[model samples]
Target: MSKPVIIIGAGGHAKVLAESLLRGDQTILGFTDPDASATLFEGIPYLGTDAIIFEHRPEEILLVNGLGSVGDNRTRQAMFSSFTAKAYRFTRVIHPSAIISHIEVEMGSGCQILAGALINPGARLGNNIIINSHAVVEHDCRIGDHVHISPGAIICGNCTIDDMAYIGASSTLKQGVNIGKGAIIAAGAVVINDVPSYTLMAGVPAQQKHQLQGGVK
Candidate 1:
């Protein structure tokens, strides 16, 4: 929460956050990406590899987790944990257009509540979370660390989404459902029952299609 911030990745998600930040007084120092040519914006300078972040002291600047997570969040989670271990705190990116019904909710660090997203009362969100554009988190939902609630995803009331679970775009979770750690819900899936850890849930009324691997459980 400072004057200037450095985005950790250069991608579509990074650009979206950049536009929102630019609307306010938030100054983007630069972005770190391995491939500089991939940077789309003209103004934001391209900082070299992610290692370049160490050039600045942790207290002087705030960092943003610009890495977008689809179904897997291990890479994003790792990046955040590495910096947090060194006492580098990531800034919260709450888009101006988002609607939050509760002010007393427990929201952890490095979370992005994006444009048009709606969070109802009693939602406790954990670190490195992305409540993507137009997504809905209903009352009393418990969302854990590094979770990616994709664009247009609807998480119903009293749902408990454990750490690193990926709720895909346009997916709907039934009330009181529990999505275990590292569970991957495919796009448009309707999750009615509880999904276990490292499981791949897909289709309407989501079925456990396979046991997922390479996920951070």
Candidate 2:
């Protein structure tokens, strides 16, 4: 039997996660959000705030990271790390319609692969990664922890996306490119070269815009 799951956010992404779990025939216990004012999220109850997590033992429920990232993933990364330290277990939520073309594709805990996403052979994804709707992860790609490949983003073969990096919606990364840790790729940007850590890259042929500090998420 699949374990009951609880989501940690109450946003649009959290609703999507709830639907994905239902499609997989998995039961969701509901969600918890400190800033949520609604009583229900897509028919699931709001189970109070962060303090509710303390009420249940880690082994009794599985947690799913429901927070979405536009460019910064520090919040998502921190939450996952914090819950993990408390002995809470997480599981991947792969939409039923997603295509996994290769047996060599490895995904870690708390990863979310949305519908229409294609993960080709030789793609390795680390913990808490998000391969969003219709995103394509080509062969021989290495994606680090807390990385978010936004909707329709295409990562070419042999590309390396480092930890906490965010590839914006519809962005395309050329083959053999290395994206540094915490780098942000803007929407519709086409990257042909390497991006440095904590840099913001944007434009047609992505160029470094400026350096970002810790709080710019």
Candidate 3:
């Protein structure tokens, strides 16, 4: 029997994850958030703050990282890491509408493949990654840890996205392009070349706009 899951957050993304779980018929226990009065889908119980999770015990309930992403993923990554350090296991949530390859695609823990996403064959994805609604990861793409492919983003064939990178909504990457760690591709940008680490890129042809800091190695 699969373990019952407790979603960890009460934000918009958390609600979406709940819907996915419900659609898939997974066992859902409840949810947790900082706000004691937080409400969830179908009136799922508010199980108090994150501190209340200690009562459940790691071996008993699986965890789902329900935090959403606007760009940076450090907080989400940190949440997964902290829970796993205490021997907690994270459950991967895949929406029924998302399409994924049946072969040559390896996805790591805490991955959320949301509604309307299409992941082509031979793509390898890492931990705590989110392939948001309507995003397309084309053939043989390699995505590193904590990467978020925002809604409507298109990653072309054989692209490499390094750790903690964020592909903004509606952005398009050309074939074989490489995105470096901590890089942020601004919304609607079109990328044709390799982007450097810790940089922010924006525009029709995507140019480096600013330098950022602190990404996973």
Candidate 4:
């Protein structure tokens, strides 16, 4: 049998990724976290920080941020860049329970597809993207790199979700809507139009509350 792959991050998100990777026929060597007081999680050892990546020399590693909120998305992007600069390869993980159409779907490394997530045919998922449990990506949706589709969010057909975008829990995107990069759609928002980048949108019809760079509304 091949050696298990390494996983970065040891928090709640990492836990889910670990299980998903295992279910996808990938071995988890261990986890790397800044705080490693705990010995094991889900029966896997919590190794020290990224230093172990160089020592163990696993074939590939998965980058898992698992941090909630859009603010964490920037942090995860930086972390992934740093890891790649150090010449470490990353892997994409998808749970076996998820339903994906046979159409061509492009996914970046370290992506997590949780149980009950349905990705329809012709969908493109970027690197390090997170399709949380039960999220539905309808046909021809394009999800950019590092975006997080919160649990139970529904992305209708032909939607374009830009990089680092966060679709809050249970939010629904109408078909063909374009969500700009780094935009945050609040929980239960029903998006009927395009969302500008770096803005926070909320409410039933999903209107922009404030510009992220300027101030909160």
* Candidate 4, 81-126: lDDT as tens digits: 7777777656666788899888797777767788899999899998
- Per-residue CA lDDT of model 2 for 1-217, tens digit only, reads 8789989898788778888999898988888998768543456878888779878999889999988877779899999999999999888999999998767888899989999999999999999999999999999899999999999999999999999899999999999999999999999999999998999999999998889875143
Error of 4 at 39 (Å): 5.1
Question: If both were scored by lDDT, which would come out higher, candidate 1 or candidate 2?
Answer: 1
Tens digit of lDDT per residue, candidate 1, span 1-217? 5558999888899998888777766989999988967684788899888899999998888999999987889999999999999989898999899999856577899899999999999999999999999999999999999999999999999999999999999999999999999999999999999999999999997998889886632
Task: Quote the positional error of residue 28 for candidate 4 in Å.
Answer: 1.3
Off by over 4 Å in 4: 1-3, 39-42, 58-71, 214-217
In model 2, which regions exceed 4 Å deviation? 39-42, 215-217
Best of the two (1, 3) by lDDT? 3
Q: Distance (Å) between predicted and true CA of 102, model 1?
A: 3.0
Instruction: Show the colliding residue pairs in model 1.
Output: none
- lDDT of the candidates, in the order given: 0.91, 0.90, 0.92, 0.79
lDDT for residue 112 in candidate 4, whole number 0-100: 75
Query: How many angstroms is residue 182 displaced in model 4 relative to the true structure, after the best TM-score fit?
Result: 0.6
lDDT of 2: 0.90
Worst 10 residues of 3 by lDDT: 208-217
